[model samples]
Target chain A: MEQTLRRRQPGETVFGYALLLLGLFVMAEGYRIDGLYSPSSAGVFPALAGLVMTVSALAIIRRIHRMRPAHIPEGSGTAREFVRRTTPADVAVMAALMLAYMLALEPVGFLGASFAFLFLSIFYLHRGGLLTALLVSTGSLAAIWVVFRVLFTVVLPSGWLFR
Target chain B: MSDSLSYFLMAWTDPQLLLLTAAGTFAGIYIGAIPGLSVTMAASILISFTFSWDVNPALALIAGVFMGGVYGGSRSAILLNIPGAPAAIATALDGFPLAKRGEAGVAIGLTTVCSFLGGFVGIAALAIAAPAISEFALLFAPRDYLLLAVMGLLLVGSLSGESLAKGLYAGALGVALGMVGMDPMTAEGRFTFGTVQLLGGIPYVAAMIGFFGVSEALAQLHNLKAPRIKQDVSRILPSWSLLRRYLPLSLRSSAIGVVIGALPGTGGDIAALMAYDQAKRTVKNPSRPFGEGAYEGVVAPESANNAAVGGAYIPMLTLGIPGDAVTAVIIGALFIHGLKPGPMLMIETPHLFWFTVGNLTLANIFMLVFGLSGIRFFAKVVETPPGILIPLILILSVVGTYAIQNSVVDVYWMLGFGLFGYFLRIYGFQVGPVVLGMILGPLMDTSYRRAMISAGDDPVAFAQEFVTSPLSLVLALAVALLVISQTPLWRGIRARLAGG
Candidate 1:
């Protein structure tokens, strides 16, 4: 069936190899636990799952290899390029900002850190100017604070700075 | 019959209790609509406040929220393509397409009525056949449950889109990921890497938000400047004719929902997915193809999830076992209120059962009212520029992740999964199976091991037991059929047989 189909895409092969690596890692790690030698052992399931993954991924690689073109197309880096192109700069920035917010959450406090992050993120995404971002951020954070703290009784991070 | 009718009206009799149910249902709709804010999170939080309250009112509020939450999930799924809850994952498959085609209003309207009808069927099943269903549910052995989970994984065959191999790989990866936390049976960590935070396991909700919400948000960035589709909110409620047309399908899906939901360790998510698959195969003339904005797709999951609510209550109320995550939390509330949740509690406190049924029924009614009326506003949500909405969604995802256990670790996990999911989506790997693996992974693992242990760790004995027990044999056959039916060989043979 695979032979009849077109060759796997550039990214597809990379993903297969990545899965192969992950399966190997999982299998290696499964043995670290005690009592995995037996079928009922703690490590058996993970190891078995890992083995299945390893085999499946190997199948993918073999299929890709068999289906590879004779010329062996020069620049096999298109997959990397696709990944790079797909995650545009704005998304990369937004993702980075989110990571920053999470890191700052406990230290800067929920309200303060959230307000700053929300304002910056909104402004960055909208590019609709900083003023609109400020109002929206403040209002949205206040609503969140009220909903979690007042309505649901979930305590937002108070922050070491606040305390 | 007279006694049952009176029990049904119990919640309506008391103004305070009725108000609580109504308010909880009203609040649940909005909470469930938010992409990252899950109903389980909301219900669990509600318990902190409701623990001290009387049992009657507390259960009433929770019941209302549970029913409303299930229906509310589809709201965001249809409008935004990001399912608010796991149960709505299948809903988004067809629903978002409908929204793109400017039928968001009709989609929401049709689903709301279907969900209400599904809720009714579930409640009716609960009311009329509680004991029998609960007993039947108890017949499931660990091996049987494992087969059921396998049956669930078969959904990837339908959900996989164009590549069965990709789906298998993705689903297998999800199962592997689910195995990361501490092994429940042996108290040994599998993939924690000597980290304390990893011991508790990656939070499934965080992964869900990452997979569906953040991934989609990133994908949407590609078309940021595309004109937002205008939703047609002209018809906010289903026409009588439309309802009549879908009534049979809704009822059938609801029955599927109740059975799956009644089983311990399974709930609305599996029920919804299975129902969607069933509709895909059974419905000969869907208004559209199953995945590309089919009304039948929306109807199957929406109805099934709602019906699963009543089904979930069956095990929790009758057998003392929580049917799903929300019910499990509600069980904690019941214990906190100094009431036991097992069979003795039911025998001793029968009123509790009837009152919950009443509460759920009322909440279903409120769900229909709020769900239908709120379409115009939710439809408008899609009209917001992607620039603003995407950022808002991310922020909400952050807050929602953080709210679960108040741990920044979960937020980080959400982000990681979100990035991974984005890559997967671009490469044509559906992210849904991964979440399914995460959700069902632990259950599958524990059941398989327990069944193995029960068989004295002998594979032959385990296989023998499956064949010996009628129930197990039936489920094993279903699993085998599910596996065989997905093969190209099977498809070829089927095609040839039909041709001949």
Candidate 2:
């Protein structure tokens, strides 16, 4: 049987450059303000940080440019396989879940929103039968609720539904 | 001595306190046994529950949890390849290999005993060294703290994944993240970007949960289809001869743990890894090399991390500065209960110091009892589907984050970090340096700026002062040597010198 070869993709290099560009932009924004105690003064550290990041990114880019791409394992044939090795789909799912969480947190109340978020996230990750997901999510939510609400006496968002 | 004995007796007589200690121990083991949950998180959560309680009970509960959580992480690291916390990363190297060979029970049992021994030694050191160390710590000016922070940042070279430069970048990024909240000196907003939530700055706990907890869950999803783990749970205890053999190594590791723990900003995770590395170097005879089911590997790390709990308290009780994030939260508890920690704390509140010592001793004993009893049940949790566990962790992370201030903003920040952290991990970036950077950044920044001001903006004066101080000079030389050892030219020269 013939083995398929794998190589580092250009897209990965592009992604690195994109991060560097974003960091540079942020650094530029940070430098725009000048005041000792002004509201705008917070930008100084971020600006300095962004500059550092940009330099590091450039170094990484140079290093990557000089390096030979890695060979794919035998029996795996195709660019798709190589991409799978590098980029995990879960990253996208996790990103989406976080976005949903941020958007829904205020509207849904801490308890209701967190419970739903937990359920969906578990389902996505576990891909288990509904019963298992429900049992786990419900148990986790109840434990959290008891700790925060009953024990700590901290007020969580009630949302319009609870109110 | 008599006053300390009475405090110890009072702690022993109080059954409720004993029970809390026991519960905290059991809970900490389970928390540590689970991959992704950390002792620090467990302690942080316990703080909220104990917030309104009296200082003694609150300290007892947090102390119990702290001891338990540190030992608990080794459980998962041994039984499964997954490390329950960063402290257990070194443990997992040898621990998982032993489990794969069907000696999971023995590995765990030995870890439990070593953890107990380590905790005791750490407390013993703390009880003896804290007064003297606190006195020394009192002499530390802002300039000294700045130097300490720089020394810590140097660890980036060791911790960075594959590339040292990358690690420095990650660490610098973390320090910047730490800079996001309110500026300490000016009380001015530096990075809030005009948002009310930004005024308070980023919460460390949220970033921690996202970085360690949420990021691990995301990574686990990639390998969800791996085969379920199976093991016999009957042979949990190590033979007497096995215990006798590793006793010296455990003691040495515990000493390392205490020393590392005493250093401000350093914690158990670093201590454990360094101890493990040192053990590999020092111990000549082994049934096998480390990371291949070596008993010394497990014993060294388990002992060191547990001992770190005692080491951490030395600074907390002596100086006002917290040794780690969990201790920082405990500092908040202390302040709320009308107690302040610092040099004068010993003079003003001797009983408080004794109470802490008593509490730590009790927490360690409870950890021993609880750690040995529940091997079978926790092993079963490994079989629980990731779908269930991951979501459950997320829920806890959210509730835990929100409970900090009951603010939805923290939850948002946590989720954002969680997403960012997941991507960072996928691209071979390490998350540990970032957390270390965030925690230590402000300390570095404030102290450096303050040191400059104190020196009248004269760089030469600052240099002269550091050189004149015996301790600072030693520390400066150590930093210089550490930097030199990392350079390619230094390596070549050292190799040549050795050859000659």
Each prediction's fraction of true contacts recovered: 0.55, 0.51
Give me the displacement of residue B20 in model 1, in angstroms: 0.9
TM-score of chain A of each: 0.78, 0.66
- Which lDDT tens digits does candidate 2 get at residues A36-141? 2332244555676678778877876766666556555677654665456544676567667767875777778876787778778777887777776787778877
lDDT, candidate 2, B272-325, per-residue tens? 876786687689997688768899989998999888888888898888878766
Q: What is the lDDT for A69 in model 2?
A: 68
Give the runs in model 1 whose Cα sits over 4 Å from its true position.
Answer: A1-10, A59-80, A161-163, B1-4
- Candidate that would win on lDDT: 1
lDDT of 1 by residue, B1-500 (tens): 57766777889999998999999898888888888888899888889888888888888888888888888889899989888898888899999899999999889998999999889989988888889999998888998888898788768544645566666666767787888878887788878988877888878889988988889988888887799999999988878888889999999999999999999888898999999988988998999987889999999999999999999999888898988999999999999998898778768887778888888989999999988886778888999878778878887888888888888888888999999998888766788888888787788888888999999999899889999999999989987877777778888887889899
- In the predicted model 2, the residue pairs found to clash are A6-A72, A42-B190, A126-B387, B181-B201
lDDT of 1 by residue, A1-163 (tens): 3227564454666776998898787777766676476667888767766776787678667766766442333573675555555677887888888888888889999888888888887888788998888888888788878887788777688899767
For all candidates, state DockQ relative to the true structure. 0.55, 0.37
